[model samples]
Target: MLRARLTLVLGIVLLAAGVAGFATAGRGLRTTSVHVGTVPVELVRPDGAAAGGAARPVVVVVHGYAGSGRLMRPFADTLARRGYLVALPDLAGHGANPQRLTEAALDRDLAAVVRYVRGLPDADPARLALVGHSMGAAAVVRAGAADRSIAATVAISIGDDAAAATRPGPRHLLAMYGAFEPSGIASTTEATGAERVVRVPLVEHIGVLFADRTHHETARWLDRALGHHPQRPVIAAKGRLVPGGLSLVGGLLILIGALLSGRTGAAPAPPDRDRPGLRVGAVLVAPIPGELAGVALAHALPNTVTGYLTGYFAGCGAALVAAALLLRRPDHPARPDHPARPDRPDRTARLARPSAAALARAGLLAAAAFAAVVLPVHAGLTDVAPHGPDWWVVALLALAVAALLAGAHALLGTPWSYAAVVALCLPMPVASLIGVAPGFLALISPLVLVLVGLHVAVCAAAGRPWWRTVLAGALTVAWPVAVVLPVLG
Candidate 1:
């Protein structure tokens, strides 16, 4: 009881600190939603700038693949504080945009944004610049090469596409990359004949976006290219990320602990009797079939990332079901009132299998807790809320995820089953990273591991049953897959 009380108090404090930190970072910024045709955009600038004020130099920042305008908020905020009017847009198929994206569409959408920004009353049309990361980097590099009017270009995490933009002109190209990035990334940028190149140290890929040095370097380069300097010091807020993450973990600890307190009696838990070696070995290969199925089926789906996820979860469900059938055994009588004996703490003793009502409660608790922690952070960091046909995808994916979790519980049992969960979930994303699945999976795969670890740790601490834990875990993992991936018709 005392430990739980301490946890509750600590969690509240951390959550408050994180929320306050994020709010403080945005103190002098004004953000508004505007549209370029059907494309949604976030227009960010200094708070006190008047409605029809003198035109300021505009910098349109674009996010990487599977990312939204919000994901590029760090860049937007930094440049806005430096007195640059920044425009962050949801490319076709990403964030709030309702249109599907394609190879040709990326350029078209970027062109639209550029044209619209050039027309903004507060924008200096002649001094327009672009800053893009990854896929967006490729887009801007191509844009800068083709359009002589673009005063400057900043490309971060650029790929082979940079080599293709070979238009030779007086382009003020600034190529930025993490030192830890692949060697090919540097060579590609160099091929563009960038006037300035920066390799931000001790970071790679996503880290480059949040790095303080990366933000500073980008602002400085743009200021030089557009020939504009801030009258005030550059405003930076990368420090808020650490406390925000801490707040998420703390909030989860409180919610899971409180919800599962009924299952975690005051008495100490008994020791495990199951063989650790056998379970570990079984779990290692358990997800292989599902991964194979998902990878194969993903090729046929319209929505690249979400399509792969759907197939992946379905494959996992099938594998879990097969494992359950092969490992079926007699059910143990309820031991709700009994303290599990140390030597016999296998499936029957530990699982004790909660009632239907209890499972429902657990599912509800997990969903609520997962949403509280994940949704706000996701919205602030990435895209807007899922809408229109997105809920249909969420419903379907949730069922498959639930099946995968339930089957995992049946085979691995209640205690230490998180290892199995991680093993089952990680392979598809890795396959994607290596080009076996949709390449975009690399963007979302890390989140899978983080969410899985979070769910396992919180549930384990709260002493929830395998079924209940799986229920919670399924919902927690599924929501991101549904919300983050692009919606294609």
Candidate 2:
């Protein structure tokens, strides 16, 4: 009965964590610099000669905090190649300038860039545009508010606070971020814009800049805003469909797997017997001793033997725990005149009963994860080679992970659910530490945190101890913040 209860609690916790992790992963402000001011702007103009001709509309790209202008070079190049005069400027305290971030300092730098671009022979002072990331985006908004010459603005992963509220000059504004951003600040900011405001879905804070979906959408948006059609008209459609397909298939697989796991049932009953409690305890403890012995032997053995001893101790521990659980079961007593009531279904089994809501939530989570993995991989692969893993690979992988999770929940019942939640929550931090594909980590982080939070919330709803749920959420979300916040400044 205790084992069954434990299993139920574990499963609930795991489910909640998985949901939260998926939701909150890759959601944070990111900044980079583009050196386009008095100092030789790091921006790369693909059409250098074109930039020297008649005054063309100047598009100044600003990087986020702690980021170098080099980061914006690719974007500037893209714009420049399309006939716009593009400038990449490093923000104050980023690249070239080591000054700390301050409203005054940033304004001065922006003013300098504006003046420089206006003075350029090729730049048209009448059609100026500013695009920025994170803090840089905020800077652009501030500049636009004060400068009437600015024609359009693109702010990625930035919120409209008091400063943005006052801005009224830009004819068009584009604000974008991942769907699961904790603050939903970007979306809120977009509401205040007078002109067109676009919100791209499935893009996280950093992902807004680099994820192929977001990147292509951004390029198209810019082109339209600039009164030009995209050179490649079907790019956006192709990018959207690819990730969308992967997410749909992955979500379906997860739902099917959950339904197939017999999770939609009531708890099973515990057998009646005088289980040997101490014997069970010994069975659990025995593995520790065996593991200790193995570790000691590994230290004395050759390096090759030591390398191969990875699972030796773990196997021993599992065996001992299994023995303990087996010994604890009570022996059957003689049947009374009336047959004993059937053992009560365990709590986990009862909780496992599939619900429409649970399935929907799981499907959404699976889709997001599917998108997170697929978009970046797609971008990376597509950039390098035309013939690579197709939509099927992404769908299969996402489905496989979801299926594994569902199976783990079923096998471990409720008690192990907590562990599973922890495992699911671990991916973002693990991915962050291990490094995901280029320009992908930002998109992935927020989804991971959201999933972890969802998992914790689910566990709490399912009656797992409140403290455990809170603890898991805190540990999963706080780790990255603790590590990154200090460095961001």
Candidate 3:
């Protein structure tokens, strides 16, 4: 069992590593780290190293606001596979770059990246291309306008500044936006070979680089504009994203196998008495404390990422205490005549067996489910809470978090179990507001609320009628309840 648990954990870590390793793989391209004074960058070159290689066509990719260079790896990989030297950099206040970030600093850092790419030994000065996503969009457009040496520019999801992005183009320009972009924003085409593509399905701003349409069209435009084509079509590249996903699947199976085999460490718990009003009241009332605590922490903590993280961590701890205290049953005076009695040996055995194992298994399964769902989405949406994370760093950190949660489950009851599981999620709403990252609470609120509501109904079910009420409530109002915070914000 210990060996199997270790196997499952290690498998999850390896899966995440696979996602990263495969994304950067191409025929002769090599990714390396370089810097220009204060700014850090990833230089992807055609051969082993950029040094001494002859000048080649260059493409510089920049990430959006609050995002790091990793978010653009897919796009960088595609361009590099086609033989273009790629420069992926973390703008000021992002990735490994400087922390004292401002708009002016970001602009300066981008200019430096352009200079680095153009000055590369094998870079083709005349075949340079500049690209950016979201906030990086405006930066790229401005950079292109200032530098005629650039051969083309692509801005994914640029807004109403069509003239700004297109008119100052370096021979060719392209704009790409997702289907859900605001009304009145449409594709663009110009006589100077400028064009736009819109309506890429099931994608939002964070997903621009991951979309097939973005890669294919962007590659085609680059080849045409730079007057270079790959010797062969690119395939099997996206297979890289598969391993991490599969690793998660593997972890899920191991856990399911454990639970099904009845290796759960704890005893089964008796169901709670049915209280339909209490169930309704819990879901309706939970968010107030969650959000209010979040807002309070936001102000109390220092205005920095470290502070942001501290406040959220503290908030979770506080919420755990609050939930435990609020839901605790009051003690009654014992009758003088009554005395406590020891349980029978067999009854003690039965109680201990299912309680710990069952709880641990359920907690582990919930955690595994979260990793499987969120990390793949994280791959596509690296714009969320990114601060230049390494391949195995988050995996290891998450393990520490799980261990901490197990401690909570040991100290408190199952209600506290659910509280700890959801507590870490509260910081996202405030984080989104302060611009550390985006699309966190907005995306997971519904899922979390549904889980909370279901926990309420199932655990508290008195019988069939009460169970139906809980299920009906969970189905009917979960979405609206979950999305309320985002709507209010």
Candidate 4:
């Protein structure tokens, strides 16, 4: 019983970790933006001048992937304050525009913005400059290469591979990138025709564009490229990594996997006495009971299935503990050598032999049903819609079920029952492959199935009774679904 409880707990923990991982991945994807087209183009002028300018140098700011022109507002405002006319334009495939960002489309859109800026009465068509961040930087580089009218250029957190070898005209070119930006590594390696290169220390790819200091530094670089001598180099102190974002989540997963494996050893051995002889009836009925129960439960209490599953897992845990205690009793037989010591006589001889084996097989089938429900629920919680209850709960319940199943097996001392349970648990991965909503849920389904299977096998080996085994199997299958349904919904 104690073994079974422990297995259930471990299983739950694994499930929790998987969910957490899914959440982290989803959050990471959400933080980035995807926008396209000309939503709003703001033109700012120095000296607090109103719009409608021409013949003055203009700086055009373009935002990155999934980002909007709004992100470039601060940069535009700063340049405007510095006596330069700033034009912030939304690129293709982002911001107000529903289209995907394509090279041909972006070039056309950028050309239109340039025309708009040039038409401004206060702006100088001869002194046009272009700036971009990330994907935006790539677009700007491509634009600069094609349009020689651009007098100067600034690429922030620019991708190295995307950098253009052909410099636009003899005009000044300034390249600024953060040291920690993975994309910047490519920038440094790529041969940009720029006469000068400015590398900023300690700034990450994203940070170099977003951080205030980095922005100021970028501004200074622009000034230098424009023939203005700023007092200091435009660079800020290296920034630190954000602690509680995607990085933290990844670290947590590594830590949890390591801790769980170390604490929970391999599955316990099955007692030899409980080994069942070949029986056609037991084999045939192995999968039917659990499938029927799972289907019935899902249909009858569609809304409350998750809760029912949780309760079932809890009961399994209790059974495992009880089985462990019973097995440890002084009266329980230790081996076949002590057959005369009737206190723990082999019950297999009295009971119809195949019946016990049938029950163990049924338990395995139940675990399979539980896994099918739990996996989808787990995926739904983390991937389909993220909410809290955390992956820890799922892992705990799975481990508990595993422990109960193992304990029962130890008590039963039968091989056929244990084998049946293992087989039933094995199908989880196959079921998961068919489909899981919210996509990312599929990532951890395999792990959950494998762990649950191991738990059932251990319990069957421990010679646990048919009733206890069946209950544990049912809970193992059900608990995760119950816990995740509310959050997923």
Candidate 5:
């Protein structure tokens, strides 16, 4: 009863906080979605700007790898409120754009969006600025260096590309990063010898995108570079989303706890013949074959986020198979002509079979959680809804995730063991992913870790048995990946 009460009270408070955060993040700005040719662009402007009035400075905010126009909302709102028109595009192989992500394709799509925004009736083409984060930063630096018309450029968390584009740029350049970012980021930013190299303290790669100081500094830099001055240059706080997001996650965990504690009786543990040490060893060593498989298939896939995810899923599946084989029991002795009596249904079968009522309840819970988390993030942070081919990708990936999770549980005989393996095994796969795919993939590693932790928490709370928890976790993880990662052909 106490758990139930906690779930009720805390969930309500957190959800309310989340709603409030989204409501106030960009309260006075006008945001709209439009197509600039084939590219999808999100345009933000000051609410009072007239359609045919005097032009405003245009700042094109570019998203990093696996990011969308919506992901840069904080920056867009900041610039828009300061009387600058902000155009954010979903680059090729990201968000709503269906094209694959390649250097050439991203360059083409970004150029097209820049031209489109520059030609807007309310935009001052002469006062254009470009601000990009990570992958977007690299692209914009290159773009700004190539085009002298761009008056200012802000590259946040840029990579080595800054070095090549560093020389001979007369325009204003500010290379900014989070203090917590890797040393390489600082080195590259400093190498550019940009007009200014500022680090926003107490934030890291993705956090910097939403940091209050980042927004303030970026808007101020752009203002000075473009010769625009508002009556007040200071920005209102945009950090409400931080606590709001935390509240939502906290609420979800509490609710899961309530469900776990409310159970009338403990579920029976499944039969396991493997020794504890062998099972643990299997889990620990699972990633080796996965890495090998991922490396082998890397060249076969496109270089987009979706492609990387496909490789990830493949690697996970390989790891699951390896672990299962390692934990497989030796056959019992039998007479020469007679085969051993058929054993009970395998672990996979047990995991695949859940009562209809349990499945329905798990599905409903997953949907509700999805709405609670994705809706607010989409409204206030980024584009986070699956579209087009991404829906199918979500389904396929969910199946793979479910199988791997259920297999791990069956082999290890406990959710905590599976969690231990995940925690230990995550870094290697992430490192391999960065090595083979986009460097910006490294920026999202922390998010992936949190996601896996959330999944384990959910399983612990919804501890009916293996199948329901696996289903819920698989759906939750798969949906976000599908929504955030691009669909590339």
Candidate 6:
């Protein structure tokens, strides 16, 4: 009854919080689905005017690689409150769009958004602007350079193709880079005579979008250039709440699961497995190299966040596998005449190889674990896998990794959950020491925390102290957040 009440209370609180946020952030904004030739785009328009009003200025806000434009509501609302129309379109392979992840495809889709927004009957084409971050910035440069009629372009935390973004044009440019943007690349610093370059302090790549300076500067530049003096900028706190709201909703669901189960969890066996080399190596030595390799490979991989994540997980996976292979001590068979009793726990017995059932369960549990954690992060915070097929890949990857853990008995604890947690817990310190950028880490941090809570709650409710359910859940989600997302961003 106590557990039931706690679960009910938490669930109600989270649900209330989410609804309040949805109401707050969604005040004047109306979301509509439009297509630029079968490529669906999500447009967030101000509720004020119809087709007959005085032509309003339009700003197309583009998201970074693998990002959903819907999540850019904070930036969109900033511009919308100032009497400008904002169109946020999901580039190919992101958001609700069904295309595969590719830069060339994104550029084409971005161009389509510009054309569509320009054609709006109540929009002033002369005041049309493009605001893009990271990959989106690159997209704007490409589109803006091709058309000189654009009034302004704001490029934030740009990529390598910035040179293409620099063709001398009549269009005004304001380029800003975060202080710790992992990709050292930036928009042209040598003023194009028409461009304004300013580096934002105390931020990294993802932070640029939400930074106060970014909001202020972007609005100020657009208002002046577009010839509109709107009201004093009222930075809405709800911008931060939208994603948090989604996470809260996910939490509510977990609480529901717990209440239904109505039992406490069984804890896993303590770490009794031998071979410190395997355990220590997986925990201590493997993460640094895996993370470093992931970051390095992110740049070299195809210019997609998905590709970078693949490289990141690949590195971490390889490191863990290598550690197991090197540290495992093979067991010798006993003589046939003196065969050991099957039921006895022999001190000299070989490390138990995981059965097919164990691997499958681990895979399924791990997938659920990752999905539980990532559901909110992707839906609210980051753009890891917002669409259908892309989300499936995340599940598949989690399953594969969990199965691998089952196979690596030398590294995994006898109960496995204890081993998984130990190995997983060691990465954060290394991540901090290497300076993975707080902006990037903050995106998934809440989701991770929520997963931890859910894991504990579910374990406690089910009357099982076994860590498999909890650890499997953690690994599924944490693999991408801790191992993949940070490296890519």
Candidate 1 lDDT, 1-489, residue by residue in tens: 677777778778877877787777777889899889988899999988644576799999998776789888888778888888999999877887777767577789999999999998788999999999988888888888889899998888888553435668337888888887666666776666778778889987777889988888888888988888687657463644665576786678678557545554554344332555654555666566667767666745546666677777777767766756565555566588976555554665454656789877776777766765675567356664675455677666677777777766666666556666777777865686677777767655777788777777766765635566666676777776677677664
| Model 6 stretches astray by more than 4 angstroms | 1-8, 50-52, 101-103, 186-194, 237-246, 249-268, 282-372, 382-392, 404-467, 470-489
lDDT of model number 4 = 0.49
lDDT of 4 by residue, 1-489 (tens): 455445455555555555564443322111113222343465555443434433456788887653556556556545655556677666654444433446677778877888877777777787778888766777777777778778777776565464555554225666667665444354542456665565667665545655666567667766766654333332211111221122323322333333333343544333434223323233334334433333333323323333223333334434434544444434455567745544444444534355676676556545544453334433332121212334344454455455435544444445554554455444333432443111122223443455455434533333334444445454544353323333222
Please provide the root mean square deviation of candidate 4 (C-alpha atoms, Å): 16.2
What's the TM-score of each model vs. the native? 0.88, 0.43, 0.64, 0.40, 0.85, 0.71
Question: In order, what is each prediction's RMSD in angstroms?
Answer: 3.9, 16.5, 9.6, 16.2, 4.9, 6.7
Of the candidates numbered 1 and 3, which has the greater lDDT value?
1
Question: Residue pairs in steric clash, candidate 5?
Answer: none
Model 5 Cα shift for residue 56 (angstroms): 2.1
Over 154-178, each residue of candidate 3 has an lDDT whose tens digit, in order, gives 8776643543445546447777776
Point out the worst 10-residue segment of candidate 1 by lDDT: 264-273
lDDT of 5 by residue, 1-489 (tens): 576677767777776776676667667789888997778998988888644577999999999877888777777767777888999898887888877677778878889988898888899999999999888888888888889899999988887554335567537988888999987787787777688889889999888887878887888898899988764464643644564575557557555756756676745555565477776676666555555554554445343444554455556655655666666775555678975445543445454666788778878767755554555556556677765444676776676567667667656656554575365436543664457644555666676666666677767766646556776677766667656766554
lDDT of 1 at 271: 36
Backbone N/Cα/C clashes per model? 0, 76, 17, 90, 0, 18
Candidate 1 clashing pairs? none
TM-score of 5: 0.85
Which model, 1 or 5, shows the larger TM-score?
A: 1
Write model 6 residue lDDT over 352-419, tens digit each, in one string.
56568756654565465456555555545655543433354454445434433333333554445334
| Candidate whose lDDT is highest | 1
Q: What range of 10 consecutive residues in model 4 has the weakest lDDT sum? A: 236-245
